[model samples]
Target: MTTATPAPTPAPAAAAETGVPAARRVPVARAYRFELVKLVAQWRIRLLVLACWIVPALFVIGVEQQSTLPSDTLFGRWMHATGWAGPLVVLGFAGTWALPLLTSVVAGDVFAAEDRLGTWRHLLVAVRSPRRIFAAKALAGLTVILLLVAGLACSGAAGGLVAVGGRPLVGLDGHVLAPGDAAGKVALAWVCVLAPTLALAAIGLLGSVTLGRSPTGLLLPALVALAMQLAQLLPLPVAVRLALPGYAFTAWNGLFTSPEQYGPLLIGVAVGLAWAVTATALAYLLFLRRDFTNPAHDGPGRRAVVLGVLPLAGLLAVTAAVLSPATGATGSGIEQAKVERSVATAFAHLYRMQTRQLNRPDVSEARLRATAACDKGSIRVPVRGPGNDWHCVVSWHLPGTDATGTAVYQLDITSDGRFVADGDGPKEVNGYFLVRTPTGDAPNPLWQFDGDVELLSHSKG
Candidate 1:
């Protein structure tokens, strides 16, 4: 009887070498290193980095030549004044969509391209574990985000310095910042942007891993970014606004002002990290549960429906729900006493600030003696909430003369202690211009506050 001895048990797979079947984890550091190497080798990534470095130079040149300043954007009003202004203007534009798009270019493609090129099985064979691969891919995407942001920041600062000259920057609070100090602030502002940029990149990676479609991966994150921006403009709750990534984008605005408010900046960082963690966790969980052995079994349509269409539809529904008009009539019944007192105080303080900027330290708020009486509409509706018909008659004395005039101001106040008032005040309310102290002459666009104005106090006088 030829009894064949049982073939020696095949050596346990490398994964089982640890004695535990599932605990066999690959070295994440090695995986991450390889991912970076792979990304760095891509021609497209090189081109993207190159673009991030070069485009700002072109933009600075182009904007410098333009006659009309883009006043609608913050810092844009001052773009023609100093080298620092160009960077601020670029930052504002980037916040709208450019930054998200640029960062997403690589992040969105990182994982989806594996699916697109039928490389998942190959990657799994080479890398061994899905979780490790996912972690590596995410790390690589984040690295790409850092590179893109850093490149833009350095290039933007260089472009601004080269094209506009390193002149002192005028702070939003009407203070003058020395060139060196302003440059540091500008660099810091760009660094702050990294938070939102990384958040957007994480979102792109999530879409890439879950949807596995190149277009969806690219479009989804961009859409989310744009939607966040739009939501900020909507009549959303303050809590919701505070949690949004778009709100974080504007956090840099405080850096350019005196007494730099780091509260918003910190909040922005928290919101961004929250977004990144949430997105990365969800993507990783989904990737772990997914089967990558058979491309034939892959359900792109189902994935699109589950991950892409449904989320987009839900976003639209939420937007509609939030924007739906209420049956009850709404009105901003602001208080007259409060409006008069607030406007008068603001006018005095702002006028003094303007005078100080003009080198006229003699022009004091006490000397101005500003006062106002406000009225609503043609018929006297109850002096309360906001209305377009609300008007104010402000009277103030211009120093060195008994010159006093009643400037008619049309006021529009929001529920949030903010107001926009247009007046036929001195010089058509064309912002204050710096002048030679004694003469107090010339109309230089030095410091101007021609648009919206917010209230100082919430309560009535």
Candidate 2:
């Protein structure tokens, strides 16, 4: 009996000899590797990866063959004609809910799955501390978010290039960008969304840690996303609106316009990071204090709720105060003279561009001089204030004809220097037309309309 105490396992003995504590013995690197391995083996994650690749690919193929362009979205009007437009369309749809849902599928499960499987005790025994596990799980979730974005963005860009070819990308400012520059801009725009996407990951992780159930974790984060989106459309004060995460979703769109803006993008990144840090901190602190032995007794602590609810309530209170009519209209002053002058100038320029695109003879920029008088709403309204109903009357001259006519334009101007003008011109605005190009004439009604109807915006100075 005394003769045989078989030697302890070599690995365990070696580990003990190192003098490191048991918890310190299992390297964080090992934890990370284990978490990553588990993540890739997940069926749901695999399915999501597949969908990311397939959906964008199919969308590209379908858009390429389609005759009509999806004109409602930012760059949809040019999707059929340019490769760069596909990413913009994809971004618009992704911002709605797709990105949040996709990231949540895995992030929501990372920690809650352990409790669901009754493996908390086992996991604790295997690790030094719950902190390592928490860190690993959070890292895994963020990794998934990045991978999904990268995969989807690359697939969309590839499908677009193959289907439509790398033609020049059109900007919201009515300017053209080289294919390389546009590609970079599109890529950066995709990257910009990642900040908010990561915040969604944090939300998922917070829910997972709190509820200890994957489905509950997933649903809560998705609901938060929906709430953010609805809040954006509320006529809240500019400060409140600008602070909403939903505004961050659209910040990247500035990259596609002339004189690309970084203000929105910076604010978006900051807000997104703030949300992520706050959620993650709550999750980490809760996990540190949670009881692992009796998992059933564990619950999202009151402190967790307080931490989460306080910030949200503060934001809501601010929003409520701003939404009160007592705050007056939530918009910057609409400079009537500035609006009239800018709109007239934009109309003249856009009309010239339209004619050039049509290759219509006898239309010169000089002859297209436009004089506009803008009235806010009805004549009794006195051309002041901003309530979406702004009208403009323009008198213009056309070349090769003694045609001097007035066109009535309806304008919708925002607090931002953005304006939309719809008018019936002397001729078809952009409808049925014969496109004459160096490649030869083709009967494509890409740019043809009646009464010269136009939509114009001036987003820059």
Candidate 3:
């Protein structure tokens, strides 16, 4: 009878017994690197990066070919004045719509794609820890987003500079910024956009974790952003508007002003961080509890959704409460004094431009001593809020004369403190739509001018 020899020790046990190390588990950094490689290899991501680099250049070229300017958008009228304005105008459009949709392309699909391909089991087996996998995927998505945004900024700046040349940029407050200064501000504006865009990405990530479907995950965040944009158009309280995610899109407006307001930017950053942290935390919890064994499982049921939403709603309510006091003082209505001051300053600047066009002696804005008195509607009520019926009478001293020149202007004001003032011209001074200059006919700055006022009051009284 032959004695059965003991089976040779298993490879892992033999390695342990021999003082040799067994294979090490994959590190989080390696998982992260793998994620980056996967993202880079995908056709969709490659196409997105290409589009970011090419689209803005084509847009700049198309705008240059057209005779009419996109005057409705901020910096649109200035596109011909300086190349720097091109990037700013493009930024306005991108912030409104493109950012949410583009960011969601990666963020929304990061997890959903694994579900779609039935690779969750394989992924979990390879990574071992769900937390590390989540971190790796999240970091990869963020890296792609940063890459796209940087590509857009650099492409836009390059295209604009090539198409229009680097002239001084005209600020919203009628101040001119040198090319160097404008470049810095443009970079900062793009940086400010990152916070809100990342918040949108977090929302996409949550949808990916909860929905378990690629299409729904992709569209959810964009639809939510669109809804918020529509809500902002309603006549809501100032505090309510400030708390909305869409408000962050317009936060860069302050950076283009004379003194550079920071209130809106600060509020935007705070709101974005609150939303991002809350959504990411919720997503992490949901991901950890997901039923990966069943590939056909279609996300959470109605009960799960309600349970998940409750905490988010409660947290947002708390955020609104904290923000209300700071924004409440401005919520009452736009003050008349603010409007008067803005109009006077804007008119003084435009009048100076008109004088320069006429080849007349230079007149200082301070010496103009411009003053405006405004009233709303046929009843002649004092202007205290936004309206299209508001009218103003502006009086200023003409150059080398004691006689005061007065002009009547019809103002159409929006709730966000932007206004278009159409002057009832003397024809000779303010001119019509276009004025004759020594070089040629040009747009009359005094005929119609845009101005913005601060919604919040800083007055001690």
Candidate 4:
């Protein structure tokens, strides 16, 4: 009876004809989920997450611990920490060691690691179409990029908040930004900073597909990055500005100030996207078409080499064409020695003019001490004022442009209540002191407060 029943089941000839089940269609969501499975297995990704939390926390602790640096005005003190020189002291060391490297670690290995484990073949087999596989990988890489960007940015802001003490953030324009506004600006600034790295991701892709090794993609992109960074400093044609990976960073800084401008940043994003698309297309074409028969004998196709080399050649060609250097520093650059003197001298002159108008006594030089000092690219000057009394504080900006660093110095003639001076209070009294840091071409009465100088005219010395 059992044998008869089994024979009857096989009588459905139509089902028997094909002798195989219908192909199971993989939904896009499932395919994407599969890609996620592959990504989670990566060791580099795990390490990146760990580093993101650990490093920034340690930095924040250190900055907060050193909170003894007296802030004359709370905002001014915070500005000191955020200013060019100050943040450079903090974030610079952190950024150089890991943050920049993380960008490569995540992006470079995402595609290349598949080849390392000989998994690309398996992936291609499951997802028959190259376009789908490529799209999945791109999406995965980009997702990781966003994670890293967000991670780094959030960690940095947290660290800065703790270190600087939560308060109104002052901008380069000297306008006080509310805590809510400052938080948003800082977050936006970090995002803006991360945008430039997209080009670096493109470079990583080219290396990933062709080299098929994590080291190749990571190291080559880093070397290329250093070269491009140095190339940016070279005197190049105005058009060349659009090509640098960091060209977008400068524009983000504008967002921190009043009158938001995005022209340069937009141009940078466009240029970065163009490079990324071209590189990704070539990477996909080579990987999909090339043979992977033997591990040792199989190599990246010739098309891969041309694709990679051409970009490198184009970069080099542009550098060679645009590089222009001066025989020596500009006149202002050479006269940097007189900066301290110029600051004091300028303050003395301005003081005389103001005092004359107010009909006050000519302040004695003996009463004058260097309270604050700074220089434009050309002339250095020291701002002098009454430190103890908080008398009239005076300052002046020399000539030329400074992209970074102290731009102007000011002296408070009368101390209302705030501002701190290290050493002898008398040392700052009737002396030149650092009142504010100068940014760009113009002088603004705002700068970050380091431990020593004070700017709040309301605060008496």
Q: For this target, which candidate reaches the highest lDDT against the unseen true structure?
A: 3
Question: Candidate 4 — number of clashing residue pairs?
Answer: 43
After superposing candidate 2, which stretches have Cα over 4 Å from the reference? Answer: 1-23, 312-349, 360-376, 379-423, 430-461
TM-score of 2: 0.79
**Can you write out model 2's per-residue Cα lDDT over 1-461, one digit (the tens) per residue?**
46777765446567679764333446677888888888989888888888887788689768889887676556776777788888778887887878878867878778878877888888777876787888888887788777888778888887888899889876654456899999999988887788788777787888888777647676766787888877664544444555565556777766755556576566667767767777788778777878887868445667657765576556546644644443343443345665666555555655656566666664654577777787876667756434468777767788656877576667665433345565544335523344465567643322321111111122223
What would the per-residue lDDT of candidate 3 be over residues 116-190, giving only the tens digit for each residue? 889998998888889988999989998999998887888888878888988888666666788999999999998
What's the distance in Å from true for residue 419, model 4? Answer: 24
List the candidates' TM-scores in order.
Answer: 0.74, 0.79, 0.90, 0.62
Give lDDT per model, in order: 0.67, 0.68, 0.79, 0.49
**Model 2 RMSD, rounded to 1 decimal:** 6.2
> Which wins on TM-score, candidate 3 or candidate 4?
3
Any runs in candidate 1 off by more than 4 Å, and if so which?
Answer: 1-26, 258-261, 297-425, 428-443, 446-461
Between candidates 1 and 2, name the one with more favorable TM-score: 2
Q: Between the candidate structures 2 and 4, which one is better when assessed by lDDT?
A: 2
The true-structure Cα RMSD of candidate 1 reads: 6.4
lDDT of 4 by residue, 1-461 (tens): 35554433333454467574444445566777777666666776877776665666565556556735334423324533442222322333333334446657766776676666777667666876666776777777777777766666666566666556556554533345676777666656655555556666767767777777637666755666666556544444424544565455444544543444354456556555656666677677766766656554233756666767787568635632442221121111112222233234334433343344344555643344423333322223322332332212233332243322222333222221112222222222222233222322211122222111111111222
Q: Order of all candidates by TM-score, from best down to worst? A: 3, 2, 1, 4
**lDDT for model 2, on a 0 to 1 scale?**
0.68
Candidate 4: C-alpha RMSD after superposition: 12.7
The window of 10 residues in a row where model 2 has the poorest summed lDDT is 448-457
Tens digits of per-residue lDDT, candidate 1, 219-258, equal 7678888888777655554444545755567767667644
